[model samples]
Each structure stands twice: as C-alpha cells, then as structure tokens.
Target: MVMTRAANIAFKPEHKITMLCLSSSGQFLSWADQSGSVSLASVGKNHTLDVKGNWHAPGTVVGLCLRGQRAYVLDDVEGLFCVNQQGEVDWHVPVAGGGFSLHEGPTDMAVVDALGRLLRVGYDGSPTDLTSQFEGILKAMYVSEFLVLSFEDGSVKALNGSQVVWNRPVRGEVGESITALGMDASGHLIIGREGYALVDGEEEALEMETWCLNGQGLLFRSDLKTRLTHITPGLGSVVCGFDNGSVTHYKDNQHQELLNTGFAVQSLMVRQNHVVVSSWFYLFGVEEGSEPWKIEHQGMPMLLESSNDGSICFFAGEDQNDWTEPEPIGFFSLKSEARDADPSELTEWFQRPDTEPERSAEEIYRVDETVENLLTEEERMLMEKPPVIGLDSLHAALDDFAFASPDDQAQGTLNVDAESLLDDLDDQLSSMAMMPDEGLFDALNEEVVAPIAPVPAAGEDQVVTCDEDGTAVVLLDGLGSEDPQNRIVMWSWVDSTGQEIATQARAKVRLSAGVHRFELRICDSEGQWSSDTIQLTLK
Candidate 1:
C-alpha cells in the first residue's frame, strides 16, 4: 500500500493532548494539551518539533490556532496569549470572564468569554470588545473579512468589523449547536446541520453527510453509510470519514466509497483525487488513483489536517495514557512538494492531478523507500542527464589531467632508486613474453620525438653484456605505473658510466664489470623529468 512512514519521533511524557490544528501557514501541525504543553510538527517530514522556546500556562490550553509562525492561544482561566514559532509569548491578555473557543481570521482572532463578551483578541495585545453582538456562541466561521457567529439560541449573525451586516434565524432548534458553517466561492454563506440550506433563499434541504461550496451548487454526501466522526469540504467535492471504518467521497451529488478499514476512522480529508484519513492506529490515504494505502504508526490516531488544495496532509497520534509526544503523520506528494517548500527540503511530490507542473529540488514520481535506495543528487544527474561525451561538454583525454603546482613540479625532479630490485625484476621478466617498437632519439634532452619501446627480438632476454649477461635480459618497466599525471612525454635509458645509452625505455648493454649503475627517467607533458636509479652487480 502507499505509505510515507519514514520514521518515528517520541516526546516528553508529561503532555496530555487536547486539540489539534494546522499552522496559519499550513506548513506545520500545532496542538496543545492539558499540561499547558504546545508542540508544532512538520507534516511531510514526519517530525515532532521541539520549538526552540518554552510555553508556560497557569492552566490547560483551551483553544488555539496557528497562523504563519505565531500561535494565538487561550487558556481555561479566560486568558489569551500569543506565542510565536519559537515558543516565545509575544503578548498576553487577561480577561475578566472564562473563555472557551478561539476562531482565527486572516489577521486576528475572535474569542468569546463565559460572561458573553465577544471581544477581538489579537494585534495590540489587548482584547477589543466587539460590542457583545452575540452570546453563547455555538460555532464561529471566518469568511473573507467577515466573522460569522452562530449563537446557542439559533441566531446566526454575519458581522463585519464588529458591526452586524446581516442576521437570520437558523433551521435547527434554539439550543442546537451548529456542527458546520461554510461559505461558497461567490461569498454566499451555507449553514448545515439538521437541515442544510443557503441563507440567500429557499433551497432543497441537503442530504449532505458533510458539506462544502464548490462555486457551483451545494455539494453534499449522498449514499449515507456509517457514524461520521469528521467531515470537511474539498476542492469540487465533500468528504466524510465514518467511525464505521469507511471513507466516502462525493462529487456531483454521487458518492463513492474509497476504502473501509475495520478500525475507527478518526479523521477524513479529500483534496481533488487525494484522500487522507486516520483510522484505528494507522494513517491511510488514496491519491492519484483508486488504490488505498496505509502508513505504519506507533500510537493511536488523534488529530488530522490537510492543505486546502489537497497536496499534502498532517496527522498525529498519541498512545493511550502514554504522555509522550504524538506520532506526526502526513500525506507526501508524488509529483512535487507544496508550492512553498523550505529551501533545505530534499524531496517533493504531487497528489493533485490538475496542479500546474512546478520545478522541485528533486522530482520523483514514486519512491519505494523500503526496498529502493534513495539516490543522491549527483547520482541522479548522472543517471537522468545526457552523457557529456557527445554533448557540448566533450573534452580531450589530455584535458583531464590537470597541471601540477610549481612546488609539485619542482619535487617531480627527485628520482627513485630501483637498483637491486630492478635487477631481480629483469631476471624474472627475461622468461616472460614481451612487445617491441623501434625509434631513434637524441641524447637525454633531445627535442626529437620519441618512439615506442622496442619489441622482444627473439625472446624476453636481451644480453646487455656480450661475455656474460648481467641477468637474462634487460627488461625496463621503469616508468611502470608511476605516471600519475599521464605526462610521461619521454623515457631515457642511461649506463653506469653516467652516459646516455639510448633515448628509449629499454635496451641491451655490453658491460665488463663487477658492479654497474644505470638510470631510467620519465618526463611529464610539462617537460619536467624525474628519474630512478638501479644498480646491478656482476660477479
């Protein structure tokens, strides 16, 4: 099955998770718990972040919303404080009455206290009383620049700048709380619950399991299945996640069942063809096709959130009564990462088919992370890009060998002593087969071009001394593998008398001696020569 289960992360045991929500920028999932502990996690990367600062509250965190890197939080004691990504509290506002929920807007948040005070808390660090227009708020929805507040008395008011612009009585009972409030693309408010309809006028009551506006008409669930724990509006569709272990997707009023995991489906989200859900102890998803997939997990699924366009998803699970940090889960794209990926990010994927093609650090369609190894960037370039041989990058063999430093060139003149060792090697090579070449050369510093080494005349042995051969033959592999720069422009042979014998690699010598000395030299393309001296003793 499809999975992005890269790794596991554990947290301190003191945290008791209460609520889960996405950051204002949708890049991270931030949640709070009973112990005043707040944590932010990167979704696609599967990591629980220990934000570099500390957040301390006198009581449990009641409600919070993350936008950008700042976390605007509310505590049980009617306290409102703003904490940034680094865990530093930017400001704190103490209210007279206890507050319950916090709804975030583009630039600020509207909070309702137990004393029925509808105050706007954000910006200047002080709560601005929004004229107490609604009380006992059942639910609040932020659309564009307007704050839509639904009160327990079944009164729905659309307020702009704390001033009521429109008021309407909802369809449910006076004390019934609104489960969902949403706005269509054209800015028309759609209220859902006992009976779903638009506030504009009379419309057919919707059979929506969960609803969302697709800019066209009411999009709702059709084939009702099991008990739903969560539902959300997706692009051009509505998605419902049921506790009956089923995820249903609806488009054009037709519903299709994607998959049924026998476990409790805690959360469900749909973005285009991508569907992400948390069920039982695992996070599962269906993207790009009808194939259902599962991700491995270490804890129970607790919270989930997704990008508006459905490119990636973030979910976390906490082990029952195990105070450690929750296992952060998310949907990874196969096309490219979210449009605003971090610079240091190494991978990108796409789930939405219609999404415009965007360049990524690495564009990988699918990665079988378990079995297939991840290729480095250089390896990928070598595998994907065309060969440099026939392309514009072609170069000569000599071009590859770089010029040595002046100091290195000066040190190149030093010679290696191969005296006795050369004699022993020559004796052995005298029994081996060899190849030959012929060339005429000037003395040591001859500007004339050099010929290749001479071929073995009749066999390996070349009698250097006419009366008695020093070894069997003179075999010169002097340059050997010592041509580090591949710049051995010429090789020279010298005798024990310090006179150049021949300007070739190997030659025969007539010597009358008890001991004799000889030298073999090599030159680089830079015209610098280095020599080795070998001594042979004849008894």
Candidate 2:
C-alpha cells in the first residue's frame, strides 16, 4: 500500500453519510450524508475547498454523478440538484413527480422519474420532459442520443422520445427478470437474464455459432464450463465477476480465474489491463504473478471507480437504515516503500521472477565499495585532531589563551608577595637586557635606567604604555627620598574570587613581560610602606 494504515481518518459519529463519489482524476473524494452537506476531501496535496450550506434533500442519497467539479445527486426528493465540489447547491431540477433513475451523457444527464417521465438535462441546469410512457415505475435506464428502457413486458425497447425506434422481446421461458443491461462497443445490446445462454445478435452469431439465443434468454458462447454472472468491459479484457467471489478475466477469447476471494463480488470495472472489483468489505487486485492483495474496509460499498493516477475510491457505509451517519470510506494506491532487508536476502528476493526490482541496490550498480568509500578514511583523519602550530610560533599559542578576561574587574583589588627577592644590582641590570633577536624585546625602553626611581611631589602619579606585544615597562616613581627600598609593581588581572592571575614583584622585574596587575609598596627606613599601597595594571 502506498499509504500507511495509521493515515486513516475517523470522522464524527453523528454525521450521517448520504453518498460518496470521486473526481475523474482521483484528486479528491466527495462525500455527503443525511445533513445534505458534502465534503470534498483531497486525495493528495490538500486544497482550499469552497464549503456550501446544506443539501436540498434531507432524504437518503440514492446515486451520484460528477463532472468537472459539479456533482448531480439523486435523493429521496426524486429531484436532481447540481452541487459544486464543496457541497454547495448550484441549481436544482425538481422532477414533476419524483426521480427514478439517471444516466450520464457528454454534457447533460438523462433522467427518468417515477411518473414514467423521460427528460433530457442540458448544461444550463434546466429539465425538458421528452416523453411519458409509463405503466408503472422506471427502474433502470441507459442514456445516449437514443435511450434504452426495460418495461413490464419483460422486453427491451429502444426509444426516441415517445416513439419506439425498435423493440426486442427477450426470449425466455418464464419468471426470470432482467438482471443487467448495457450496450457493447459495436452498439449491439447485451442483456443478462435469469436463465442459461449468453446470446449474440443475428450478425455476431455467424462466426461463433456456439453462442446462440435460447428460449430461457441465456446465451452460451460454447459448451465449456464458464459462467458470467455480471459483465463489464475493460481495455483489453472483459471482467465478469462471479457470484462465488471469483472474478474471471477474458482476453482474446481465453479466460483466467483470479484469486478465490471469499466475499460476494458486487461490481467489476476495467480500465486497461488492470481489473478492479468491489466485493463485500474487500477490494482485490491482480497483476502478473504477485499475490492478490485484499484491502478490507468496515462498511458495505455501493459504487467503485478508478482514477487516472491508479488510485481507487469506493462508497461504503450503512446503506439501508441510517443514511445520515457517515461511514469509513477509503482510497488505495499500489506503490512500494523502502524496507530494511539483509543484503543476501534482498539479492535472492530480487532474483525471483515475481519480486519487484531491488531499489536498495541501485547505488551498487554504478561503483564498487573501493570507489564508494574513497573519502571516508580521509574525512575521519581530519576530524581526529585539532590543527597543530609550530614551536617557533609560541606567541601564537599565548594569543589563543584567554589571559585577562573582562569579567575579572568585579572585585576590588589584587595583591602579590614573593618569598625570595633578588637584590643583586647586576641581576637587576640583566633584567633590562634586550633580546633583539626575538620579538620579545620590541617593547624595551632602556633609556629609563638612569632615573630608575624618582621622588615625586605630593599627590603625583605616573602613566606607562605597553607595546603591541602586550609588554609594559615599569619605573618606580612618586616615592620620597626617605624610602631607601624602591619597588616597581604592576597589577595584571583580578579574578572574580579576588585571586591574582599574574603580577610583577621585584625592584626591577621583567616578569616574562606580559599584561599583569602590579602593586608598588615602598618601605621607609623604619620598614613601613610609603603612605599606603598603590596599584596599577600593565598592558
């Protein structure tokens, strides 16, 4: 099945179902119930439908015929109402008395009513009674330019208005009634009576004299064991569904019995080589070698039709008592969906003559595994590791690390103290040596060594700038001469927890020369910090 079982829809229980019909293209299925309302449900992609009010007939819907988007419904009122796909009434033609039967034509409908009135309906939604020749009620009718009618005489009559063009009295023993009637492609009348022989007209019987008209009105083409309970034409086959739930296919005068369906066959339709049958709750399909699939429904169906896209729609529900309650009506299409199967099992299945083509192996047809998985290994290698940087690019490594984040400024200040402080003057001088061969010495300003520590006037501070490499040069200043130990400090970063990330603590410290928070504290001869501790941040 092309669609899944879960896709089935359930409607409100109280909405009565009157009739159901599908569009010619199978694009939509229009259903109407006792409320005289119709819903044109889309078959594929949904469309914005134009909903109409209520139906004119509150009675049970007897039959329905659709053309373009307009539908003609025959209901209990015995009248014909022209309704759009949305169930809105376009127009109505009330039969003078009551409608009996209706047949479709090229652009109009031929209607026969209970009063034995014959009428021709034009595209304009108007009715013109052509004749009235009824002894009782009109049961069945077939429409063309010329109409054929079965009357109380157990005879078939071809009529052109009130005048009879020709009449063929059915040759039968007695008591049997006309079961089915239709016209073949050659315009010869085909009738099925309650007796034995299957008959052909005078001209057609010449080649096949085996099939002759009998007194019981049953015509048999041959003495062979073949029974045709109901017959309908197909493109290349004649479909005759039997009473035993078996649909027989006849092609070139040969017959093939299909699956022994357990349900009574109600109707048969043929559109080419495809055969569509509507039995009790089951729908059957027969192709070449595949098993017949029976799609079962919950209600009894009254009509079946196939769409051009190969989907079928049928009417099923409560046909007798309550026509108001809508039943479950469904659409079915033949399509294959992907399923998971083992490779070897799938190969064996495809090798079987009856199985459909293997869609999962389509990629294997173009290339083998060696060519298909070419880029897999290379892609895995690329995903395994981060990109590598050369050792000479150590500064690039530091650039990747988040040093002094902007979020660390929430706290007050950061302080640092060293356990061992180098007091060698030469070591202090070496700290100012420039490594010009490397990029680290780019920010060195050696000229500031002469006035390393300067006494400042009261309330004076100094400003220092760092190079593009984030290295800052610090000089001790703003201390009185009474303080012998001059200290240079830089405050780099303070985290949210008041922890110092990196700070400079020395008389003259290189401190790896990066951004840091510094605190310069000058101790006087009494070993006291000048005034109070001061803090600054190096770039």
Candidate 3:
C-alpha cells in the first residue's frame, strides 16, 4: 500500500549511514556514513531540514551526539571531535583505545572508550580520565553528577566520584546480558534483561507481560502476547512496541492498542500528542482521534526524534544492503495525512493466496471423471491396452527384422530399409552426443534483460469547496510518477468519459461542485504504459 503522506528527503549522503543522532529539541540532526563523512542539518520550520555543514572523520564513526548546533562524534580509529555548524572542528581529543559511547552533560561531555575507560571532557576539549575500576563495561551513561555503568557479568553500579552510590548484582542466571536500561521521570533506575527487570534491585518478571512506571513511582503491569522491543513514556501514558509489531498504550491501569505494523518494531519516540513508531522500512505516526499515517523509507529507521509539541519528526538509518543506492534521512510534519490502512484493509492484506486449498474426495473424483470424458477413443484404447512385447520378444523381433530378406520385408508392414536406416540413425545420434562449441555455450549463458515497469503516481485525492463563482480551480499532479531510467516521455490525463484533458505532468483545471475522477497514464521510453487514478470531490 502507498503512504498517504509524502515524506521529504532532507539529504542523501554518498555512502551508507553508520550512525545518526538528533538533539533533544529535535532542532539539529547529525549523521555519519561508512566513508567517515559526517554532516549536520538544522530542522527548520514545518519540519524542513537543511544541511548546515559537513566534515570528514578520521575513521568509522561509532557514536554520535548533538548539542545545540554543534556535533560530538566518536570514531573507532580517532578519539573524538567537537564540530561546529560550519564544518569546523572546535576541538579534537585523542582518546586511547578508541571510544564506544559519547554523552553530553550540563557543562562537560562523557566518553567511554573500548578499554572500559570513562573520561569526562570539558568544553575546552580537555579530557580527564575517570576511574578504570570496572572492566568489561558494556554501556555507560552520565546523568546529572553520577556515572552509571553496566558490565558484561550482568552487574550494574552507579558511582559518584569513586564512591559507590548503589549497586545491583546479577539477578538472572549467570551470563545473562542486559538488554535495556534507562531512568524514568521519577529518578528511578529501571534495568531490563531478557525475561524481567530490576527497579532499585527489586526483581519484576515480565514474561509475556508488559509494565510501566508512572512519574509518581507507581508500577503497572499488563498481559501481553510477546516481549517488548521498545518502550517510551508519554504525557499520561506509557507506550510499548513489541516484537510482534503491536504498539500498546497503558495508563490508569488500562491499556489500548495503537497500531500493529506487521513487522518487528525497531524504535519508538513520543511527542506531546503523537507516537512515532519504526518497524522494518516504514515509520508510523499516530495521533489522537486520527488514523495513523505512515512514511516508507528505503532502509530500516533506527533513529527517531520528534519535536516537543508533536509538530515535526526526523528519522534516519542505515541501508539494509538491498537498494542499488543508499537512502537518505527524511523529516516530515505530522500535520499531513499519512494514513496507511484501517482494520478491514489490514485483514485483507494479510490473507494472501499463497497456496491452493485441498480438494475434497468428492471434488477429486469429479475432476477425474471430467478428465476421462475429455479423452478420445484412441487415447482410451491405448490406456486399456497391455504391453505388446516382453524384453526378450523385442530383441527377437529386432533380430528378425535385421536379417529378413527383401521379399520377406516387403511382405511385412515395414517399407523402409531397416538396416541402412538404423546405421545412419546411430551415426547421427553419436554426432549429436558430442559437446557443443564454446560460442554456443556462451550464447546460452548470456543474461537476459527484463523490461522495466513504470510506476505512475497520480498523487493524493483532493477535496475542495467552490468559491462564490460556483467553481474551483484544482491542480492535478502526476509528478510523483517515475521510470527507473528517467525515460518517462509522455503523460496524459483522462476524464471519466475517456476524454484526454491534459498531456503534462501537472495541470490546472476548473470544476464545479461535483465528484470527478481523473486517470493519469505515463509512458516510458520503451513504449510501456502505466496508469493511476485519483478522485476529487468538490462542494
């Protein structure tokens, strides 16, 4: 199904994206590609994005964070760099053993390298090494004046200047890895693993269930069909996206389903009144009292950032290695109509005709009877007849035919010279069994080019009201139509009566208060035609 709202591409990098970061206010976006190229864009009004600057990193970027108009990038080979909006590096610090995570504090930034070293860098780019007491650190987060660390042994510790604030030992069986960790609005640490979570060292099993903690330290749990992949706290409710493609909202000891994407949800973000969900290659935006709108991406959307008032959202991610070219990051305003499908449409979508149904015994017998009735008299006789000769009898018959005299052969049913004809046939068969020429094999192995199908998008349907003149001027758009080779040579718009009205990609026409339909047909260079129809309702 096509997306109801069109998603605008902000910028496309030359290489595949490796990491993406969006600022807390959703005003600045920064991304890095596989080629070590980094770019920063400013999300302007109406969710429009403009690339402000671009720079090249020394190595592959592993982590990225944005603060205001500047970007903090951590690469695998180099340490870190604070870049301004004009592509200028404000400062560069050589991090030992490379970096894993980068977090921005109120005045300084935190960096965790590959060797479990935590360093805090000031605004002037001077990095002070913190304690390295913890080994095999998997993740580190700097919040307020404390550093929270999770280890490979499933242990967690919060430190304040070498002083242990609180520690939680491994809760599950030995070697169980931590899957998610975050701080709620009430300043409570929530740590999630495979089948459960730990709230202040208290075990909460979450198998086949969902849970949420409100701002008042109240915990709520609900039964679920699958495990949760992502959870985001909203204004008065908590939304959770599951591995089964369902997004559920829980609040006031009640739950309601938002939408199901039919694919494993990858990420989620919540704005004031909108919930943005990402699954596979599509992003869904759902708002109160409105159908959810979707925007399809060329790659899986891994990063989602939304504005404070739910007016705009920006998303970006790496390509899934299936496209001929890498996809760009995109931003869209939530005010547009981006509905995907309703409940009935989704039901019809999933019931595909993949295989034929089994036939009943009576139906099978009727099919056999119909086949028998279609056979000719000769075919029926051949089916009833038995083998005419055994193996030894066939050999005797051949021997007799080979040695028969000319007069005896004439008396038999055969008319041709059996011995001479057999000799020639053997010679021809021997020659035919030989291998063919290399050129002939090469011709057989040549690849065949398939015809390219043109995609004709007639744009969205429109609804308008007539002016005092009892007519309205409407614009019919077919610019979204495309051919892969950029070979679209002709565009035609036909009215309901099969009358050609326009021959351009876009046309303006006047109509009265009535319902009208227009069909847009596009022709490619290869003389292939594809068409799409759009409806317009006027009042």
Instruction: Please list the C-alpha lDDT of all candidates, in the order they appear.
Output: 0.56, 0.49, 0.70
Question: What is the overall TM-score of model 1 with all chains considered together?
Answer: 0.49
Q: Is candidate 2 or candidate 3 better by TM-score?
A: 3
Q: Candidate 1: where are CA atoms >4 Å away?
A: 1-7, 10-14, 20-29, 39-50, 114-117, 126-129, 172-177, 183-190, 195-231, 242-246, 260-265, 306-313, 322-539
lDDT of 3 at 243: 77
lDDT (10s digit) by residue, model 2, range 1-539: 32111113323325655566667787656667756555655555432223333345655465577777777876546477787755577888777645656777665677765444566786578665555554322335543445666553346666655456655555544323444554433334455444322443311111110111222332333322323445665545355666578776655555578655667777776654556677775556665554555444455554565566454444455433332335555444443322333333422311234446666666657656565466687786886668777654654644533334446544542221222223444677798997476444644644454323423222223344666655443443333333233432222322222222222221222222333333333332232333223344454
> What are the per-residue Cα lDDT tens digits for candidate 1 across 12-32?
334545667775335666777
Decide which is better by lDDT, 1 or 3: 3
Q: Write the per-residue lDDT of candidate 3 for residues 374-491, one digit (tens) a residue.
A: 8999999998899686757755665634445567765544444667878978999998897889999999999986767779999889889999977787888998886676777678
Clashes of each: 18, 22, 1
- Maximum-lDDT candidate: 3
The per-residue C-alpha lDDT of model 1 at residue 282 equals: 72
